[model samples]
Target: MERQLPNFLKNYGSILLLLLGIVVGSIVGGFFPEIVAWLKPLGDIFLNLLFAAVIPLLFFAIASAVANIDGSQKLGRIISTMAGVFLGTVIIAALCTIIVLWFFPVDAPQVAQETADELLQGNPGDTWGDKLVRFVTVDEFYKLLSRENMLAFVIFSFLVGIAAMRSGETGASFRKFLISGNEVMKQLLILIMKIAPIGLGAYFAYQVGTIGPELFGFYAKPLGLYYILGAFYFIVFFSLYAYAAGGKHGVNRFWRNNILPSATAISTCSSIATMPVNLSVAPKMGIPAAVANVVIPLGTTLHKDGSSMSSIVKIYVAFVLIGWDFFDPMTLLTALGITILVSIVAGGIPNGGYIGEMLMISVYGLPTEAIPAVMIIGTLVDPMATLLNATGDNVAAMLVAKFAGARGTLSAADGLNTDDADGTD
Candidate 1:
């Protein structure tokens, strides 16, 4: 009887459960708002668990992936190709967003006078040089533990990985140890995820209940548009990329295997949370562990198609609210540059879109009063945006593997053993 359950549901049951939670929570919250409000802590605890795993998981996964690379020249080629593709795709996404916004302009909501006054008073003084300095160097080792310093940790990990790779036997031993640690972290993540449905349910319920259905009605037009465009990118853009990297069959297989991860990203609204699912499925999709390990972790930090799209939308919305001409050549240029930069650094941050919102304010020279307005748009569109980002990471991995001269599609045997930390047969 248990075996009679459908394969897709069994495989993606967590997402189903999460959706159930959302629906049920919304209903209960709608009828009895006070009870659902009390459930907020359940969701908060789960989110914290997910965030706790991110820093260590990223550090170990990335370092192990780089150390495991066969040689420096090969790693160089892979990294270069991957970076080019990542940037190109993000630019394309941003352009598409701009085009869409140009054709269908969204009216921005008015900010409260008090809110505007509060927002305009703060000074963020973070220049490009300051950001660069922060990225490349940490003032203290402990600073790396802070969520805002993820880029610094990534840089440090890359150097450690390269040094370990060059250390011959010593490096090899260390790499093994790092790999083991990564495995342990994956296991920890799995245990945390076991309770995700409850956490997500409580969270979504509280959100929907407190905000009420009127909130959706208020933002429906823009949110609906964002979801439609995001889906187009996920299904159309990714499928086309998959077809190019592999073929018709490869596209079919890639889409089939990606269901769970994409669903998870949409439900959780997190690319970081989706990493484990991507790592597990990459092998099944024929991506080499060496490539998946490096690319997926790195992509989690550097690649963010969903956030890029969301940023473009937010910037456009902000422009309309502020009465700025978005079509100006200089305006377009600035948006492109800042969106790309913000998307790259936005990953691994706990609040998702808060940092990106600040970058838009700083780079676009918007009034500090604009932050609340931009955040509203971000909150509305984040889930769909994250779905695109998480799914795009898998597509990026496949493309990187192909460009780096991986022989056609490797078998599942060539992939990582997702069941164990060591990934052994």
Candidate 2:
């Protein structure tokens, strides 16, 4: 009976939870608007628990992954792959920003003087020098990098992974420990997954009910644009890159092999939670365990293409709201460059979007109140952002796998076999 219960839950849990969150959140939003306040904390608690697990998971997964790389002679290849990822992300960001600016120019709307006066409240960060100083200081820096802090945690985890690779036997033991830890996390996450449906339902219901019909208009156009770009990038840009660089069988098969994991990431919107699936799927696509291990974990923190892109868009919206033209050539160029730079530097931190957007607000001398607007933007665009982010990571892993010359997917005789029927061919 005990064994039967585990199996039953394992099969049906996620569906159950999703329904529960929607029902609960919807009911709360519809009939208990006043009690909606309590539901907010419940949502926050769930997110916080998820956030708490991210940093440690990243640290172990990355270290273990790096330590397991097979080929000593492939260092140059790995570096080249890393370069591809960096360059590809920058290009994607530039393209996204330019396209959005050109197509979806936001018109300024006039609000009452009193309403504008009310919005002029709040302070974001500081002056350039002051913020830069704060950014570089050890304490603030640490806070920035922690998983809860996110950016700092990413930086530290990468350093630790590198150090672990060099530590020889201790590194091996630590790697084993990390692998074990990751498995444990996977089990715990499976448990969490059961409740996720409930949480998602509740959250969405609350959001839809509270925001009401008027809020729908606020997101309509921008959301449309976001989805259009998201699809274009995924289907055209990524597919082209994979095929061009990976060969027909190679890239196509890789995509097929890893679709489930990528889909999971899109649905969950949490890269850290998707790691177990990624690790399992990657090898099927011929990604070496070493490359798979290192790339996916590291990518979670660093390659938030969708998140950062949405952020830049939010700032543009703010500028539009403040009655500034968004397409002034110089302003456009500066915004693109700044978004990419700040996003990269702030990578690996918790809520890097928050920090990056705050930095942008300071840098541009924009009103601090813009943060709430940006937060709304982020929330609305998160699923698409997570999808792009997960896709980017997979592409990065493929490139790395190619460069590493790892054995698995190179043979044509495999005839599109995958580790699992759902994974890359």
Candidate 3:
């Protein structure tokens, strides 16, 4: 216990301090009221600093991780299984958001809408094809470099990584540069995080004091909904998934071993950081080391159920601000597609989904004001997000084990459209 105590504090100390700062600031803002003017600027400065750094950080992180794919992803069958499970789970999470938002719609923040208005004014009548094209790629290379072109940037980074991988020995220097740039961005993120407490505190103060209760309500509704939905999904969906993986025993083993990892994810607010715990617990649940080794590590960056749910909420918040119909069939479908993309890429970019938020902005043409309102949602809901993100990987490993033919693996998909005479199975 003594040995573990230092590690525990080392992991949680910063988070605790940041929470304290937010709490203290909120109380002052709510009661004192007069100090929010100065406090708001501190928050603005922090957010501005964040927005400036994330572009390069996202680029390097995605490109570098993809470049290293040759080493990290060796298990071919397990990779396919993980992909299937990851996408299925995230889609379920997003559909849950759709249902919840229908009953409990979130309103736009009561901040000034003039800027958003100007940006949305004269909404162009571009064809669906043009809109579709712009959603994934920009016409010019320089346009892809900006925050407003996030999806374009993501696609470009992916291509660059794949090109490097395909070039073999000739691309070694470029690969190294990508990795080194990724490391530098990580350090830059660390430097930005060091000021998180003060910035969050200041922002919370201003929000409580002057931004109107509606703005708080703007965040509160989604935050509350997320916890309720997260808990529900964690218990119900995961148990069902475990049962599918290995019947009653799998369910029992998963619950018993999952508590610590769930706790770690919520405390650390990081899927990557919680991965060691998942790796440690996988064997006790009867998951193959091969499955755990592949699923848990790759899942850290590629699988994201929590982010899927939150992405919908974030997009809905923007839709409300823009006066769009959230329940429109086409809009809901578009939201779902974007949610999946965000969940997948969000892990790679880090910084609590700000890059994901940027993706939302670019794809939908959301205005700049949406950034402040939506970026904090990621941080606020991160504990649950990380909880879903991390533990889902563990459960996924179990499923991957089953899919790889560990005792009575689920094979319905293979049976659906195949014939024994074909001999493919």
In lDDT terms, which candidate is top? Answer: 3
* Candidate order, lDDT descending: 3, 1, 2
lDDT of 1: 0.71
How do all the candidates rank in terms of TM-score, highest first?
A: 3, 2, 1
Give the CA lDDT, 0 to 100, for residue 168 in model 1: 86
**What does candidate 2 score on TM?**
0.59
Candidate 1 has a TM-score of 0.58
Task: Kindly indicate the candidate among 2 and 3 with the higher lDDT.
Answer: 3
By summed lDDT, the worst window of 10 consecutive residues in model 3 runs over: 416-425
lDDT of 3 by residue, 1-425 (tens): 89777876776676677778877887888888898888878877887777788778878887887787795576667787788988898899899988998898776665544334555553378888977787788888888877777777888888888888887889999999999998888888778878878887887787678655566667788889888988999999999999998777677778877888887887677788888988887766677676787888888888888889888888877777666667889878878888877776667554647767867776776765566557567667777888898999988888888877653232322222222212111
Give me the displacement of residue 360 in model 3, in angstroms. 2.2
Error in Å for residue 398 of model 1? 0.9
- Model 2 segments more than 4 A misplaced: 1-77, 112-218, 345-350, 403-421
RMSD of each: 9.0, 7.9, 6.7
lDDT of each: 0.71, 0.60, 0.77
- Runs in model 3 deviating more than 4 A are 1-9, 17-41, 107-119, 200-210, 321-323, 348-350, 406-425
